[model samples]
Target: MSEHKPYTYVTASIHEGVTRFDVSFCTSEMSAKAFGGDGERPFLTLSSTEAHMTVTTTGGGPVTEQDVTLAREIFTASARYLANCERLHAEQPVNPTDQTTPSGEVAA
Candidate 1:
């Protein structure tokens, strides 16, 4: 069996109308517990957020939006793969019609 039982994942949480999330890429057991919130890779928060989107990384990391989607195929593929792997309990229905898919390059 793999060591990482829970597996690395992304999580979305909403509080006071703010939609927050964390993307965990770390796999080490010791490291995972230490961070308490998805290791030190980076934490993301997207506020409710009709059309405007501002990307913020916790710990004030210098990650730019450019790094968010370096490769369309790769990014979309990753999102698809994680959607199945991540232990998510989504509050919102998975909208298959969401034009926000990276493959489209634009959200309708």
Candidate 2:
């Protein structure tokens, strides 16, 4: 069986001092020989808004198309649950606290 490539897309917006994100993803199924089943048609899945946080403050410049596109990609790829087995993995941690190092760790 051959590995399938996964696709991702993202969208973002700010409202009421909060940042909102949305994401979409799609992937194809491996051949049946890989799963020990009859060959099945490819599949597609989507996930979004698993978790989010408010910006509270803006440093500068208005939102740009690049920012929006990046945000959308982030949200889509990181949704709560994916419908497809072959899916893109979220790069950022679901929780900020989880990303933080221990007190002894130095801040970069």
Candidate 3:
């Protein structure tokens, strides 16, 4: 088996020493223009609007079993990571005044 090259699908530019991220999912837009007519559909689409990423499998052969397994693993890992982040944030103080600084100073 050959090692697959790492590809960067998304990027963010830093400004004012801060890289802010606005997390949001695309509200699935469906129209007649979208593909799907049940004939010879040949490509797998993996899209993430938040990251502005749209990856598609293009080739003569179909995706291998390993590819499906890897995709499932990726989905599981991503879901877990998002859940963990939400859980951590949910545990934070609800009020800004309840927040504290690194020096044990409470926010005013």
Candidate 4:
């Protein structure tokens, strides 16, 4: 059997209402030989706001010698995240459609 190489992946974590994520890109040993480091390296990141209402990506550009579908991967992950957000929002007990305040005044 041929030796296995690590595959690119993404991970997520939540802390203090903030969701932090990381994207790891796999670097082949051959690429490492031609380039420098091998294995998985952080390629991108996504983070959530304090209110857990928004998610933003914060990271530098990827520096690598290998050719990979970086854009597709990122877009796929983002789409999944948005879908999950929508699902969770739908599952919330509080109705977001209700805009009336306790004083019976319409929230502006």
Q: What is every candidate's alpha-carbon RMSD to the true fold? A: 17.9, 18.4, 14.2, 18.5
> Model 2: clashing residue pairs?
10-72, 10-73, 11-72, 23-76, 24-76
Clashes of each: 0, 5, 0, 0
**Where does candidate 2 have its weakest 10-residue lDDT segment?**
28-37
Which is the leading candidate under lDDT? 3
Ranking of candidates on TM-score, top first = 3, 4, 1, 2
| Residue 57 lDDT (model 1) | 46
Q: If candidate 4 were superposed on the true structure by all CA atoms, what would the RMSD be?
A: 18.5
- Candidate 1 per-residue lDDT, tens place, 12-100, comes to 89999999977654443322111114344443332221221233343356545654553345458768877865533232224545534
Write model 4 residue lDDT over 7-64, tens digit each, in one string.
6566789999999986554433212112223643343332222211122222333533
Candidate 2 residue-wise lDDT, 1-108, digit = tens: 255567555689999999987754443322111111154322222333332222211233455566557656755864634534223223333345565334433333
Deviation in Å, model 4, residue 41 alpha carbon: 18
TM-score to native of every candidate shown: 0.22, 0.21, 0.40, 0.29
What's the lDDT for residue 21 in model 4?
80
**Candidate 2 vs 3: which has more lDDT:** 3
Cα lDDT computed for each candidate against the true fold? 0.45, 0.42, 0.50, 0.48
Name the candidate that leads on TM-score: 3
Q: Could you tell which candidate, 1 or 3, scores higher by TM-score?
A: 3
